[model samples]
Each structure stands twice: as structure tokens, then as C-alpha cells.
Target: MKAVLAIVLCAFSAVGCGTRTSSEMKNIYKEDQDGVRRRDAKAEEMRYALSFGGCTYSLIAQNYAITAAHCSEESGALGTSGAAMAAGQKEAKDVQLDSLIESGLGSDYKIYKIKWTSKKYMKAQHIWTKFALKKSAVKLSIKPAKGDAVSTVGFPYDGEGQAIVSTGFLKKVSNYIVDPYSEIEGSGLYFNAGITGGNSGGPLFRASDETLLGLTVSGDTPSYYSPNRPESSWSADENDVWNIATPIWVVHEKSQAFRSIVQGGTP
Candidate 1:
């Protein structure tokens, strides 16, 4: 497959990650390329599955959770007509999608802040939430070199509250465009793994050990440009494969800045 998998940033929204897949489509019961279905009993993997705002996230820090910036209303899904807030769902003023997200993550979770958000594209928010978990959060570290094996752990298709896992090799470290308009964000690490909707903000970890590599943020599939209509750019076909992530180093670099902002200091 030589298709360009465009960044499926947030899966829930209309323009998000696209359709949800069944276990039959991807066979969650069986192992994926160099990856296996995480047993429900895996404590570490289970600790990483976080449900909130119609998406899944990784518990990156004890009090901090990382998710795609589009997970919030900034993605145009929080409009008055947006389905983000269900009927009868109510919160205090200014607590729209953020409030819904906080509630979805559980009463223990709250909106800590956001980072790497684009005012133009409004897609790479890197939504951060604060909460406590029974286990320690994954530590953010340097990005893995190309060819390094990595695995994704999160609630695929919501996985009935279970965390699903997939493995692939680190393809490269680069930037991924969200759309043809030319908007972009943080450095993205591409992996060979295939992630369906509901896997956004999941952890991309080193397979040999559980060390964190990055966070799975988006997947993309590109449409072939037709020659009859010559306005299209004839880029190499990406085969509609490959997944992308915002490297953990971005978060690691901003952790102190985020903390400072929360503490009433300049970030």
C-alpha cells in the first residue's frame, strides 16, 4: 500500500479519525505486526487507557494526561450545533467541552491546561488533563531513532473499557500536515502500526521495555490525484498506511513550562 495516511487527528468528530473498526476488521483477538492483543490483566497497559471526551488517552504523568488538541471544542466540534455536549448535559459557564472532557475522564480528572495548540488550524492542542491513577504514569523521554520497534497501547474502538495494543517499527521523525491548507504542528514520529479510531492520545512505547517513545495522535490515508484534473499535487502515494505521533520530547520540554503556567507564572 502506497497511500498517504493523512493525520486522523480526533476520531470522534466528523473530520476526525474516520469510522470505527470491529475486532473482525483488525482482529484484536490476534496479534498485529510484531504486536499482540494486550491481555485485560496487564496492569501497566491498563493504566494507560484513559477515556474522556469521546476519545482515549495515555496517562503520561501522574497528574497529567495527554491527548490530541482537537479533542476539545477548538476542533469546531464544540459549536452550538456540535454533538460534543449531549442533550441535558450541563455545566457552569465557560465549561463546555473542557467540562465534558473533565467529567469523561472521571471525577478525579480536571483540565490542567493545553499546549502546542494552533490558533489557525486548531488541531494540535495536545490537551492535558490532571488526575490521579493507581499506578505511575509513563515517563516522557527522547524520541526513538528510526527503525526502533514501538507499540501502541490504548482503548481501540473503546475496546469495551479494555486497552488494545499494536506494534510497529519507528518509520521516521518528521512533520505531518493536518490538511492541504498548510497548517502544521510539533515534530511527528511515524510508525508502521495501523491504529483505528478511538486510539488517539494513546501511548507509543518502546517494545523491548515499557519506556515511552511518544503519543499516537493521528493516522492518515491520502487520495490519489487524478491527471485529468491537473490542479492536484502528485505526491508519492503513502499507500494509505502509517501512523503519526507528537513526540514525547515536546511534552517533556514543556512540562516545566506547563507547571509554571499552572502556578500563576509565565510559561
Candidate 2:
């Protein structure tokens, strides 16, 4: 059999090393190329599985939660549509999908019921990029910081072939996109790791006591074009590097709107 394996290389300007000046380990999460678990610290969190006609996103949040609007658009399901689809149900029906996600489905998944959707943010986006998780069953709100550690969970190439649970370390203050920085609050979470196409919208989490920081936004340097053609303008290889991701923090307001459904107490 041919030997096929996943490789994780770390070294980039995104993490903003040396200048940031921190004694902490800058690895997003330490994992083997095969994605085997040396530590399952973020197992308790929720994985927001998203699907799109072109791509599937985990809709990873900053607080160990996963969700994807693009995925819902392709599935014709929306938490606010009063008709969300279920894992077993093929038809898109008006029902809360969060409970199905919160129950901890036999080590394969964790169930989380949608009490109330984040209407504010969910409405502002192009639709595919705006969605969130909630359950009218909590209180209080806490803001995450720049250097907070977070974890990630997602289904890439069937969820097993690729590594999961990336650990993220804080990098710096920079604009991922020129002028568009204001669109994302002019701030971003940078980390060193091995993430790519299938990993988009995957969960980005924190494990100090189990909290979310953001989603798996982007990788160090990836091909803007097809991977097969490295020299192409689209290829984010040695010549061109492009890192992109929808910041989970953008939905903070929506999260606050459904404060009643905010799960968990402070650590």
C-alpha cells in the first residue's frame, strides 16, 4: 500500500513570534500527523458541523462550540426558520437541532439544543456565514482575550483521515485583510498549526478549564489556487500565502441576545 499521511508544519508571520514577546508555547495544539489524541481536553465542547455545496464547515466558535451557516444553507436548514434538520432526519424540518447536538452522542458527537437562534447576527450576514447555538438555559457573559487558548473539532475527509482538536496560542494585533480589518473588528487570533481546506469552520477552543476562543479560521500559508499547481497565482505555496476565516467573535452580540440560553457557568 502506498504510504499516505498528514503532515503538520509550523512557522509563519501570523503568530507574530519574537516580536510579541511571550514565554508561552505558540503551538495551536500539539497532535501527531495522523491526528491521534495525546490529550482530549476539549472533548466536552460542541462541534458545529456545517455543510455547503462546495465546502463543509464545523462553524467553530471561540468557546469550544461549532456551527456553520454555509452548511445550513446547503442543507436548507436554519435554527431560526423554525425548521432545523436533525442528523437522522433527511428532511429539513422546523425543530431545534441543538438538543440533538448536546446529548453527547456516544463518543461520536455531543448534543446541544437550539433554544433560540442568534437573530441579530444571523440576519446581518450573507446568510451562509451567520448562525449560532443557544438554549434559553443560562446567564452571565464573559469576554475572551487575545492570548486565550482554544481547541478545534471538525469533520474533514469524513472526520477521521484528518487531525482534530487543534490547540491555539495567541499571536498578535494585525489586519488579516487590508481595510477589511474593520469588518472583523480589526483584530484576529493567530496561531501556529496544520489546518487546511477541509478544516475550515472547524472548532477553535481553549482547555485551561474548557472555554471557547474562536473557530479554526485559517492556516499559516495555504494555496490561494489549486494545490496541484504550486506556481499558479491561486496556490498559496512558497510564492503566495493566504489565510482566511470568519471570526466567531463577530457573533458575540447575538450570543448576548440569547443570554438565557448561554450554557455553562464561569470557570
Candidate 3:
């Protein structure tokens, strides 16, 4: 009687295992198709993304693009301004910016006119055409509320030259005063989207409408902070940090050249 009971239990366990395996097998093909669709959609959205100076930029017009002010040649932050390469391009093209239109110090945003000289004219046109065809140019939105879903498109250092997209929600909006003596005030959009060195100057888009919300500027690192009160204890955990972005409103408020571009006029 004990052997009979043991045999029945084994049979039931095998039936349950078989059922789960069959159900999972049926979903595998569907899951693969869904993944493919997502990848294709992301590729289309990032068609206008460009890589340059070990950072990312988005082509908003045929001859204009936006990036972080720190990424400009004048900043000396990245040391060298390298060639720019559009997505799907086999070779990078030597591109030059006419001038830097920055939103003051510490604001961390800039718009520049691409210099399309004779050598780069044809290729630049070709790249812009592809970008326009995909309607990848994003519109700017100054207002971003906390908890708003957002996405970032850029070439991370670890991405091996391929564009990587990260998604997160807006965590906070605050003023980042880099220098108290200089009295320079800037606005920052704090989010949790993972970003790295090469992602600097990349666009941070609102997930719902794809509007340009900000530009990726810095990521959190382990550091120390002190509060005014002596009893408070605080330490910067390497893991407990938020990625920051320069809100687009900073440029809108500070740069006249940026306004012209946004108003459908040449910068």
C-alpha cells in the first residue's frame, strides 16, 4: 500500500512539471517577437543620435545640434573635440561647430551651429536627410514634473559605440549652485536613469511624448556631505546617488540663440 501511494505522488509531480514546460515553450516564440519589435522601435527613435568627442549629441536641424556646455571645445572638459558620427554610419565625419551658445556657467547646456564646409557638405546633408526621414528631431519642453517617466539616448562608454537607451522617472527638480562666490545658479533635473562618461551631452526625453526634457550631464559618485546641524550624520554611498541632467529650461531662459532655433528661425 505504501509503494502504491508513492507511485501516485510521483506521477502527479511529473504531470505538473510537464505542464509548466509546455506552457513556457508556447510563450518563447511570442516573447522573442515582442523583443524584436521593441528593438526596432528604439532604433527608429534614436536614428538622429550622434556620437562625438566621446559624448552624444542629437541633430535637431540640418546644421544645428544641442549638447552639454561642458562638452563644448571651449570647456576643456573632454580635452579634445572629436569627429561626429551619426547612427548606422560606417565612418565618422570631421565636423566643426561655428560657435558655442552656452547658457552661462554652471547651466551645463549649449547649442551650436554645425559648420558645413565644402569637405563635409555632402555627407552632412546625407546624415540630416536620414534623421529627418525618421522624424527624430525632438521638441523641447521646459516643464518636467517629478515622477514623470523619462528616457535617455546615448553612447555609453561600455556600449562599444552602439547607442544605449535607459529609462527612469524624474526624481527631483532643484537648483544646482556650483559656485557660491560667483553666484551662478543653474537648474538640474535629477533622475535615476543609469548614465556614464560617454553619455554626457545626450538628450533626456520624456517617455510619453518624446519631448526633450534635459541633457545628461553628470552621474552620482561616492562623496561626503555635511549638514548644518552637528548631530546629523551623513555619508555618500557609491550606490545611493542620482544621475543629474541640465534642464532644457535653463537654456531657454538664458540663451537667445537657442530661442531663435526653437522659434523656427536660424540660430
Which is the leading candidate under TM-score?
3
Global fold similarity of model 2 (TM-score): 0.40
After TM-score superposition, what is the CA distance of residue 29 in candidate 2 from its true location, in Å? 9.2
lDDT of each: 0.43, 0.31, 0.50
Per-residue lDDT tens digits for candidate 3, residues 153-239, read 776544545666766556666666433346566666776565555667788776566577777876621121112522112111112
Clash pairs for candidate 3: none
TM agreement with the true structure for every prediction: 0.53, 0.40, 0.60
Q: Can you give the lDDT of residue 135 in candidate 3?
A: 15
* Tens digits of per-residue lDDT for model 2, 103-195: 111111121343223332322211122322221111112222233444454433322222334443443323443122232233334543334
Query: Model 3: how far is 133 from its true place, Å?
Result: 26
Q: What tens-digit string does per-residue lDDT give for candidate 1 at 29-61?
A: 234323423333244344444444355554332
Q: lDDT: which candidate is best?
A: 3
State the lDDT at 103 in candidate 3: 44
Error (Å) of candidate 3 at residue 226 is 17
